[model samples]
Target: MLEARDTVEHEIWWEIKGGTSNVWYENWTKLGALNYVVPTDYPINEELVDVSDLIEGGAWNDQLLHQSFPADIAEHIKSEIYIDQLQGNWDRPWWMLTSTGRYTVNSAWNMLRHRDHEDSDFKQLCIKGVPFKIYFLLWRVLKGRIPTDDVLMKMKIPIASKCYCCSIPQQETIQHLFLTGQFATDVWQVFKNAVGIHMNLTQMKQVRYPCLKNAPFLWNELIDFLEGYKPILVSKIVYWNLPYDGWYKCNSDGASRGNPGPSSYGFCVRNCHGDLVYTECKELGINTSMVAKAMALKKGLMYCFENDLQPLIMETDSLIMKNVVEGIWECPWSIVAEVDIIKKLKARCNVLILHVYREGNSLAYFLTNLAFYFAGTSRFNSFVDLPSAGKRIINMDKQQIPNIRIRNAKNTSGMDIFT
Candidate 1:
């Protein structure tokens, strides 16, 4: 008998019997003989042993008796046998091995195993941050697959014992997020109002919990609630003028450098949210301050009407122009025709003309200066260079009454249309 170390440093004893001396010597030289034992094919029925049991049972069958086994020898043997069997090409789903590697039943594997088809839902889940386990849970929640506490615990989300938002001692699940949080309650209320649906808070919570899974309609309702609630919250903020949450306010102005000499006009329009809707300047040929005022009013009015807005409050730095517009003073004859037409248009809406200080109207003056710079090199008489703001106002007037014309220097040059 001969004894020596095998691959894992485990001792193997070889019994030499009935073999030629030369064969025994060759086996010994190759280290194939262990403890002077020569290799021999022992006839054993391998067919009777269940492969699964063989892998699982491990050292339960005492085939080798050279050494004593450890406390977990049986388990270690079973694990090794199972891995060997897996490598031996047993017919099973590829996912069983793949999932065993990652310890996760990824989506691709799950879809292969189950055949209920939903391409849209499947595509959505393929996005990052969606775990296979979580997606399965959501699908079950949508399909009424209420998981047991053990299954949920297996998911390994942090804070498994309580709701993350409210710290309630329960499974931190989707239902808790939607129904229990204070923010969620406010959101639900706004959502109900937006979709023209009325539901008590408690009723909404109850209905959503039980029906969310297994009901497509309920899933759609949840989607709609999420999508529509934000804009309604914004609208409420604007209507109430809440700080940092309301609509903006904008102010516009127009300026003319010299009455009837190298004139330019500027105007601005803004919303209650304080956003600049439009701002522009135009060079008008040899026009007075009154003409600039008329031009600015035209631009501002056009902007409001085109945007389908009303109840506008327009401010100008020209006190005389503001007074004339509001019927507090008479306008000059040179521009009264245009002013009268604008006043008539203004009366069609809730328009208020107020005189702002020149300091408050600086943006319009800046724009007017820009217009002068550009217009200095252009032809003065043609209306093609008129700002789009002015064009919008002119279009609005034409829409209101066909063929409305204001006589300028070409017809009744000195007549005041307001008279």
Candidate 2:
């Protein structure tokens, strides 16, 4: 009929035939009809079996398009081909029947799936290349896939050696490195002293094995305790100034540049009889001048609170800082918070913030200079005799001062002593 029709009719007939071919091909694929190739001696009578039987129990009725092929079959073809694209195997020739106007979806899915599988295989190979014991230990520690200690001990180590620090005969493991080793105990002591917290130092198995296995919060506490204390201890110091009776005087200062750059703070406490009680210096990392001021204030407060000292007078060259602390003027929000903390600490002691001329704050200035010198090498936390270099500088400054003091003292007479 199509062959005998005029050009327009023939074109429509040809389109109908093509559409039918595509639909048949898609249905055949879904029903597994294509699994068997065309047989050489096919039975002519039964050649086209009723494919409709295969569609009865499946997802056919939900997709009928009001076309031919029992409503169910029509629906099946429309849905599986148009919506789900089940025959969409673009990697081979199978996808041609299922794709809509274009077959690119099948092509894209195949390419992406292949690439993903290849990348996954590559990663597996990379992981397999790592040494077995090292990999297992790291995996156990990181992923909580730990084997029993006995099983771990039986596993091969690249280097067969007992623990280095403790010399006890046992396989080197993360547990041993952190728990049983003498070095680990030393580290724990420093940790305990710094935070003022103590815990039983014993074998990993003794400290609640399940804490290591499931309680991540407890594990983190151990890690944080170990990591935080070393620096804190190195920076801790006792400082005092002024001697009573026969005691010597110790003075301290804190300075910051550009508001929040590297800061230097120092303190030297002297007994009533003029004997040096203790001295300390510190170089604080980038922090506001206000922060440095607060830190210095805290140091004094801590010293007084810890030592049971009274009538303690802390001095800084910053008059504005002093006034702010005394509530004589409003402080910037940044400074106020620190001032408030200091005030809270101050309430526990006989503490006073005295504003002095930068000149009068010479000892603190000298200590700050020393702090800068020891910035990276060591933290100034203990009572050390004055460094020779600092002593020389102090003596030199003192000697040069006699020549100028008389004239300055006369000129400055009647000025407010506090000013």
Candidate 3:
């Protein structure tokens, strides 16, 4: 317990209520504990009791906060942390590692595991629906515990190390069995050809087919995936839908020249009567596509807050951002800060962020593309100000005319071994 004290301290989120949590020590705010960032010589008033001292009349004591801490810390406290005013409420400690904020054995196990989960390779290697024996085999291969001739010889077995699967007289090492030998090469070739997978497998050593391990499909699964897939006539009609009366819709999008290269975000607002009201776009410098998508929604939410766009429906084409913001999926660590800010903005603005197909978000898509050519931000306040193509989309949306989205969906009718 003593050894884990420092490490587990970071996972406990102190939910401030009556705010008895220590102002300098507790992690009620995501900006981190105050003592870590505050100056050691900074003056502290002994009379100040706890976090509740900074709250007055069911709201944050802004003036006191500004006087007590730096400007940024004060802002973070106000934005990220909220308070409840129940008379006997206590600051609850929640396990931050789990989605439900409750401690679980699985979450703890995942955190304490020695394997590198950050690589997202574990799930790929342990393909679901694959037999338990296959899983055991893969695990043994990874651990170099498989009973290959080299391993058997090391175990003091009195037998010549000879290849079991082929005519070659090569020593039956793990590498030869899985990677370099002729039999392994043929198996890999069949797997690759069947799966139509193209990957650079030259750099990996002792692994015959690194790509297959990294892919979600197993070797047997590829047989069906290759012969089972055929072009089927499938069409999905994606179109912009107008918000109900007394509400507005904000469609936002993000664009990146390369995934982490010159990224940009754009948003457009439309009233129930289908009038293009406000639109804005700006480049986000160098950032990932995920960040760009999240920032776009955040900017849209901010606009809603500023314009009093209440009972608003916000839409974006980023499914990941939608699920993350809605708490349906885990938030990626890279954009945890941005997602936090977005969640607060979403709650404060009373905005419902939903995922829309890219075809339905054409106007915002146009604005996102426009940001690339411009050096700075751009804004439009009127429908008349929109370019011809933008105006055309709005007009079509006004008439409820759907923009057709046709996709060549693969026919999965040919059933085979899913396992």
Candidate 4:
């Protein structure tokens, strides 16, 4: 009985007369009714079954209801037996503009109005710390304002509207460029590999609707990843500061020659006043970046446990490690073993994982890189002093000297991003 241009939110009901409305196709009851006809092997007299055929004297024909439909759906029909009580068995229309079973023109008009609110993801893109250029580009991308080939052609541009990134003749639409282009797909794969997120990059191109729909989430994660590594302006070298009151700070880093080649992990523990409590470095055989980072975190936690350092705050330049440790994301199978140990260590001690810029973590970075000079693992006890380079970096951090400047790149793929 419902007939409106936009009737998705509207509700329909029927007053029983001669049972003319088809029980299956017709919107004869509230949403809780059997809205769609469930096919079964039972025979029916016609394509449409009216309400009367399923009703008996003052009640539902239980045998017929059971024979004609599944149990759950039959029970739903049985619950609406009050429909048989219409005065004099006369049929009429019942409209439901409001969920409270009241119909009003004003309510109907309001329901038909377009929504006036931005998606939560859009609000995230507009957060204060985000660069204006990056924010604007993401906003445009979400609104389909980017200059894809189809949009360019519509604007009368002379260039052919074909995919250039993939070197394919396929028309370059927004979906094709971001979600299907071969080059774009390959870049995404590299990014996923480098970051160690537990998702298949190929699925971005394989699954059309879901991949494009979650683009905002993917962008948000990328921005977060970049935030951990964004370089700050190097003015004067500063010394590393200690953790806040009642917490010990541990800075950790991982170094690899060829990513999957020989690698090492290092961590330095400092008191609240930037005094070095201890430091340790381990030489790990061939392993991926993900494994190395995970090991570094695990090593730092172990150092704290061995030294009885409680309520520790661990800092690392690897966003992937921090995210995985904090349960923000998943780790790949290769690094799951390390992550599991890290989790157990974290649970044992009052541990907090923080992601910092590499510039701020120079001492840990140095120690990790320094492992390259030594053939075996190295450990410095409380009585020992840090080597010259490590001491120099620590001094710089304590001085609050800027070691690097963070800057946004002109464009990443088709969008501006911080580099």
- Candidate 4 residue lDDT tens string, 1-419: 16653364335565455566667655555432344445555455464367776767856788988877778667766652334232444344455554333467776666667556778999888988889999998888889999888888888888766776776668989888877789878888888778665374434423533323223346567455445643223233333456789779999999788977989888889877677788888777786667777778877887788788988889998988888777888655445545766886777788878878787788788888888778877877652467877777666666666675344443233342323
* Better candidate by TM-score, 1 or 3: 3
Write the residue-wise lDDT of candidate 2 on 1-419 in tens digits: 35432222211111111122233222232332221322434323233233332233433433333432444444534432322112323211222222221335455445434544455433453485698877566555655355534345567534445655664556656666666667777888898778655554323433544223322346667666545632111111112234334423335567777656888777656456433456667777776666666666666556656776666667777777778788887755444435655676667666667776556566567776677768542333333457765555345443444211111221223442232
User: Candidate 3, residues 1-419: lDDT per residue as tens digits?
Assistant: 57766656766677664677788776767455777767888776566668888888888889999888888788867764544353567876767776457787677656666446353544666777999888788777877998888898888998887887887679998889999999998999898868665454222211453323223255565555545645444556777988989899999998888887999999999888989889999997887888788778878887887889888999998988999988999876445656766876776766788888898998899999989988878998998887788888888888888877665533334332111
| Whole-model lDDT, model 4 | 0.69
Candidate 4: C-alpha RMSD after superposition: 24.8
When 1 and 4 are scored with TM-score, the better candidate is 4
Candidates' C-alpha lDDT: 0.47, 0.49, 0.77, 0.69
Where is model 2 poorest over a 10-residue stretch in terms of lDDT? 9-18
- Model 4 off-target regions past 4 Å? 1-241, 382-384, 406-408, 411-419
Better of 1 and 2 by lDDT: 2
How good is model 3 by TM-score? 0.56
- State model 2's lDDT: 0.49
Number of the predicted model whose TM-score against the real structure is largest = 3
TM-score, prediction 1: 0.30
Q: What TM-score would each prediction reach against the true structure?
A: 0.30, 0.35, 0.56, 0.42
Cα RMSDs, all models: 38.0, 34.3, 9.4, 24.8
- By TM-score, highest first, what's the ranking? 3, 4, 2, 1
In candidate 2, how many Å is residue 347 off? 1.9
lDDT of 1 by residue, 1-419 (tens): 12311221221111112222232222211233222332244333334223233223323344431122232443333321113112333322111123121224354345445656667965676678888898876677655456544346677734345554553455545565557665566788898888756664434644555323322346667567545632111111101111122332223444556655777776665455434456666777666666677777666665666575556767677777777777777655444434655676676765666665554454455566668778432222223444565444434332332222233332223444323
